[model samples]
Target: MASHLLLMRHAKSSWDDSGLSDHERPLNKRGRRASGLVARTLVARGYAPDVIWSSDAARTLETAKRLIRIIPGAQTVHHNPALYHASANTMLTIMQRESEPGGRLMIMAHNPGMAELYNLITGHYHRFPTGACAVFKRIGKAPWHDPQSWRVVDMVLPRDLEAE
Candidate 1:
């Protein structure tokens, strides 16, 4: 079965103060704008997902919500605490286990892991900035286990949205 995975990095966050926990940090104004633009771009590109999984962090959740707003459906968006600061291996495991048969999956989470996961899946280094997204097309009959089976379909960053 063919499947597509969209991995997104959480939008820019506010760090004006140091007291807040990492999970509690909210998206800054620029983050909000960039996320909206990306959401619109996804809609325009017909990249809506059947399932959405996101980190429990405030910024990540907010980014997912904004993306959902553009899609407009009754799909449930899962908030997984494990995704908050998960490693690439952890993220891959989650994706492999949770992905539905022949369905698109979208995940919103944090850095190094996101970049690492992209590289692992596509076999190419991908620098994921805030609000960046990488789309992978999986063609194997089995689930998303081997990274070599996935192909990088598209990748976009917030700066790329400026040209759209």
Candidate 2:
């Protein structure tokens, strides 16, 4: 059976608190709003994931919380410190290692890793802005690690949604 893979960058984060480390910074006001909008859009489009893998950073966790609240279909979210600013290979390895066999999976993380992953899978350059998601459809019984097995289905960007 086919499954869905969603790679999303965390929403815009606050740099207001200069004292706070990058990992400790939370989402900004615009980010919070964008998070809700993206979550709602995902549900409306029937793209909600069965499970979520997210970076343990404050922004990513906050984004995940917003998604969970809006999309009740997601089973659970696993936060991993290793995912924080991870490279594309690292993200792919962790995803393959932690993912369930056959179900929709979402990764809430940071870039340029997110963008790199999208490029690696689709063989095309894609801008993965904050609060943006790239949806891929995994063909039947294909390995998640195989780029040939997945096809880009959609690119959901907060900017486009905001303009609507």
Candidate 3:
């Protein structure tokens, strides 16, 4: 059976505090609302992750927490500091080394990496706006390190759900 993989970019962050480091920036008002929308959308689409591997950054952590609140079945959440601004290859490497086998998994982190990783895996370029998720079905018996093994299945974007 194929396993599910979800890649999510952190929700929009607040730029109000110039003194705060990038990692310390919190989710803004729009981010908070968008996170909830994304969470509900995940549940509605039956794509709620079994486990989440997320950046330790404030925005990503808050996003993961929102998901946990709405997704009753969401089980574990791991905060990885290395994922804060990791590259696409780094993200895949970490997942391959850390993720458990045969369950829905999610990665929540910053962009450039998120968008790059999506394009690498799906063979299609996508600009991952804040609070966007790319859902994939990993092909049978293939490892997470293999880009060709993943097939893009669905997407959940905050803008797309604004009317919902």
> Per-prediction count of colliding residue pairs?
0, 0, 0
Q: Scored by Cα lDDT, where does model 1 land?
A: 0.82
TM-score attained by model 1: 0.91
Residues 46-90 of candidate 1 have per-residue lDDT tens digits of 676667889999999998888888775617689999998888999
Better of 1 and 2 by lDDT: 2
Alpha-carbon local distance difference test for all models? 0.82, 0.88, 0.89
In model 2, where is the ten-residue run with the lowest total lDDT? Answer: 95-104
> For model 2, what is the alpha-carbon lDDT of residue 63?
96
TM-score of each: 0.91, 0.95, 0.95
Model 3 sits at a Cα RMSD from the real structure of 1.4
lDDT tens digits, residues 1-164, model 3?
A: 33888999999999999999998999999999999999889888888898898999999999899889889878878999999999999997886786455578899999899999999987788899999999998886666667777898999999999986
Q: Rank the candidates by TM-score, best first.
A: 3, 2, 1
Which stretches of model 2 miss by more than 4 angstroms? Answer: 99-101
